[model samples]
Target chain A: MSEQDWRAIRAEAIESLLVERGLLDPADVDRVIETYNDRVGPMNGARMVARAWCDPDFKARLLADGTAAMAEFDFGGAQTEKLVVVENTPDTHNVVVCTLCSCYPWAVLGLPPRWYKDPAYRSRIVREPRRVLAEFGLVLDDDVRVRVWDSSAEVRYLVLPRRPADADGLDEAALAQRVTRDAMIGVAQP
Target chain B: MDGIHDLGGRAGFGPVEREADEPAFHERWEARVFAMIGAAAAAGAYRNADQFRHAIERIRPDAYLCDGYYGRWLAGLETLLREAGIVQADELRARIAALGGDPTRPGGARPAEAPDRVAYPPAGEGNRRSVAAAPVFAEGDRVRTASFGVSGHTRLPAYARGRRGTVTTWHGAWVFPDSNAHGRGEQPQHLYTVVFDGVDLWGAAAEPGTAVSLDLFEPYLTAWTAEVDT
Candidate 1:
């Protein structure tokens, strides 16, 4: 009688029904989950960010055309058909949210975090971003312009976080390790 | 339609809960539901993300709030499957019963699928379109978002309705979700990145030096005229 039990059973029932009807292949379902859970995720994004940080030429191309630039790394599918990279600078800080729905860059970031889909974030981030970012432990200077990008359409956004203050000596691989998913999402500094 | 899914600027919601080291899915069922949607899309049950989202938007306001993210996704999947005739109401109940679950619960039996026709874009092709028509508004054009009180799905959030903003970037042509969600063909239009000043949206309560940007379709905007100013 528990709700969790119902959800589990209901999910099972639906999958089985689809499998029985030959509309869906169970293997395909497993493949899809594995693709997002394993193959695709924020690590791919970090690698791209790290590449951008190390290679000025690559960064210019990425800032100009994110979808085409990322295609060089063979990263384009599903939610990332149109990828737009927003850079974070000392004068301007950028963050992304899907107010209408949880429209995230799945190919780059795999899946969105729970807080990204939470009603609290959906409702308040655009209105009171300073407070929300502060809650996320990112306090912008009063002069830094805060730009919140609402992924209202198919154009997905990935925040190109500024290189950390102490990251001058790090290589691309080492730099990628320092990039957290939240920092790419513009909630924290890399 | 104005629904609970449009949670842009409403107040009283609590602070966001940031779970440390969160997995993609909290439970196996949630992952299954997530894959179920992807599988359904692959199986030709749903056309695009817009259709899938409209199903989620169709959820009742009360249930919309009660059901978590994947929970709503599960509900939307059930709705889509039932509409596609891939699943039947009786079969769902029987499966629940076979699984030793009570079928009388409110979540078990869902509302009937829409009587409206379904529209599908070419498989592997998303909302993007190649139209020869020029963009209605160019970048830096001062425009106002129209107050489109559409009865079906829309991307224009409640907070930005009738608000004035400057077009910062043009995103080329894309399918308009309002028509696409209701079995209408992909009405591709010019999409732009419009930047609205925080003060323009939230008035004096806005944080200083803050701006909100949205990817708005051409249909959702009009050229701002000084003659119409208050």
Candidate 2:
């Protein structure tokens, strides 16, 4: 059998072991998977970002204390208990990474992307963020101060990418459509 | 510990690659492993979240790299199961054989659980803790990260060691991973957002007009006196 096949069998064996011991129920596992896969993800973050773009007061609260501001939308949970939102101004561009582990803001952004968890990105982004971001097709100007936030502790970071110049007339929902996961991660512009 | 899992500032891993249309999970096994980890934690199989993280860090360097994210997670879960005395090697082999795999494959014996470790908090209880003592350093204070040689789990990355930075924001107190990873109680400490100049971290190789910010706990920092720079 292929390595993949063996892995599947190994996983099944462990699951059965845990179930037999009353430590786990297959139904509970399914519920956990569905929660992250469907109920949580980038859309939650996009809605918050869209509201910030449209409303000045919400944006002020979000930048001041992301964890408290998220309560207004009833949107904070696991992996984001203490949320911190960094804004990207014309002179400053912000990015987020976790050098120790893939400590992502899961409540808002869902599971981290493959690249976000990859060793190359983890190792190099803090040392050379401009080059790393450039490789992701985001070439920042030399004058823009790049701020790389490494979430080493419990506090998780979410980058509020600068709203595009052309998105002036868009409504909150329309503005939300432009906020992609990569943009919130500070690798792309919405 | 300065293990292979601490990848910050190390080079030669190559460029970051993104999938064309990356799914939330690459495969069914990945999803199963993810859920299994949650189930294990909920079952009180782990002392704390830090202990689970240290399990993955304890992986043999070569083997750790061989597997992807979920794969490393699987290895960690197996390690936890064995260490907790919940699963034995013979049982694993027998189950594998029953499921039609080669039982002759080498497997190590189960390890005895550490008797001195602290118990994990109930499933939903987070790491946040409230303390009456005020934070040592306030926002806008110049501080220097403490340089220590610890052979245990620490959130302080090697790249940021011994660097001088400013406390940009105070995040209140949080569970210190170094103590918690060893089955120690949650010795929560004041945490802050320290922003360091890129040049201070990377020296000549740093990009101009760039800064690296880290959420650091109080024990990792001290006041950066002006005399220290001179």
Candidate 3:
């Protein structure tokens, strides 16, 4: 090749060095990519929300100890150990953003949406949350408090939106299907 | 350091591009780079989360904005590894030259070796741990931020420094990033959720009636004094 992606070559060089040193395995790298790509996503979080919707005691544990509560569903990994579940009632709506960076609970949300990592979102959401919410097509009532939790520290945030009225009789699986990733991140209501 | 990465409230960057059915990685290289960073960290060449993050902050302001999200991660990963002597700059250069000469360069045949940074201790295991320092404030306590001219890695974002806010929640003691970022010991301090009025931070730029808040470590704050607010 006359010219190429320097970053790609640099990455390859780094991997080769690690492989030569016996510190990194190519297979392990493939496994990691597979885990994030196919195995993880909002479904894990939706399951947790569904359990909380149907089981009051489980919801208590989820709000109190997110990591342990998630253990009920066997969902815990990188960036998810210290999760703070923010419940959204009719009076309060919460949205999460990592102003410093896109510090999402990757294990639950899978990779973050590009919008979550956008520079504009990082700056605006905390200052003009209502305006930003409206842009996302969510218009909160004036009385409802819009709380934007900035991930300035290690703690991750997950939104437990209020269970919908018609969803009251649905079983956990059906309720889980109703919970969207945007609702879990507090940008939309299920 | 007031790097471009601390992007709260600064302007001119455009709209949030919400993709329709986005994939985990946009390029094959991105996926490889992501895996490489994680694997190398697990293999013992690393920085703790705070120190690792500071590496991203330490990036030149222009490059921080110019680089892709994971591209910045690759940059930070390389910077930390190079600084720690896990990877040699010259060897990387020569290997890049070789690969640039041939895009299909076979894997694991590189002439360079990443030195063992693991023998010392791993960095980037930044997590919650118990510490002996007594917390300086608590929830509901009015506090004033201390203003300092730090030209190094700092968790106290420039926007909120020297501003007064009420402590809304005590997140318990966590690693003080200001100290930890410099390879200094974890002088753990109480981290709190400090709620500040929008005007306090943004003034004319703030949306009226909106308030912004963030989690701040204890070292970055002090007890509120009536004289300071006015």
Tell me the whole-model lDDT of each prediction, alpha carbons only.
0.87, 0.84, 0.75
Checking candidate 2 for backbone clashes, the offending pairs are B1-B152
Better of 1 and 2 by lDDT: 1
C-alpha RMSD between model 3 and the true structure: 4.6
Interface RMSD of each: 1.3, 1.4, 2.3
Better by DockQ, candidate 3 or 1: 1
Model 1 per-residue lDDT at B16: 91
lDDT of 2 by residue, A46-81 (tens): 999999999999999999999888788788677887
Question: How many backbone overlaps does candidate 3 show?
Answer: 7
Q: Which ten residues in a row have the lowest lDDT in candidate 3 chain B?
A: B107-116
Q: What digit string (tens of lDDT, one per residue) describes model 2 on residues B51-126? A: 8888888777776666778777887888788777787767987898899977674322223234334465633368
Chain B TM-score for each model? 0.93, 0.90, 0.84
| Cα deviation of A44, candidate 2, in Å | 0.6
Of the two candidates 1 and 3, the one with more favorable lDDT, higher being better, is 1
Model 1 residue B101 CA deviation (Å) reads: 1.7
lDDT for each residue of candidate 1 in A90-140, tens digit (9 for 90 to 100): 999999999998999988998999889989999999999999999999999
Q: What is candidate 3's lDDT per residue for B1-230, written digit by digit as tens?
A: 66687787777766565777787777777777787777757755555666667667766666666666776777777776676667877776777777763433322211112222223343235467676776778778998887873765676767778888889878777777676666666667788888887778777877655676678888788898788666
Docking class of 2: medium
